[model samples]
Target: MRCIIMSNELTKKAAEMLLNGATLLSEPCPYCKGVRVMKDGNALCVNCGKNLK
Candidate 1:
């Protein structure tokens, strides 16, 4: 298994999303296979550190 590390920015983003009531999704990101979250219809990739569809 491979270990993944998130940068400070990504970590902060995830925390912010959670704090703002974003829902963490079970599906993985298609680009990098990272964990995803959704908020107000926006999908964000916590591992890849970007917004998804």
Candidate 2:
């Protein structure tokens, strides 16, 4: 349902971020326990799709 759509969006965002040179972090996201990425000193949660600090 809504979660599926959200997941798709998150996947797309993660792919785009990675393609743009974002680094996939080894640590997990604190909020959703999902994979995290970093680029230009910013962190992003691939599952939550949130731009974290």
How well is each residue in 1-53 modelled by candidate 2, as lDDT tens digits? 98889988888888888999999999899888899888888888878877887
Q: Write the per-residue lDDT of candidate 1 for residues 1-53, one digit (tens) a residue.
A: 23244555676888898899999989998888988889998888877777876
How high is each candidate's TM-score?
A: 0.77, 0.85
How much does candidate 2 score in TM-score? 0.85
Name the best candidate (by TM-score). 2
Candidate 1 Cα misplacement greater than 4 A, ranges: 1-6
Which ten-residue region of model 2 has the weakest summed lDDT? 44-53
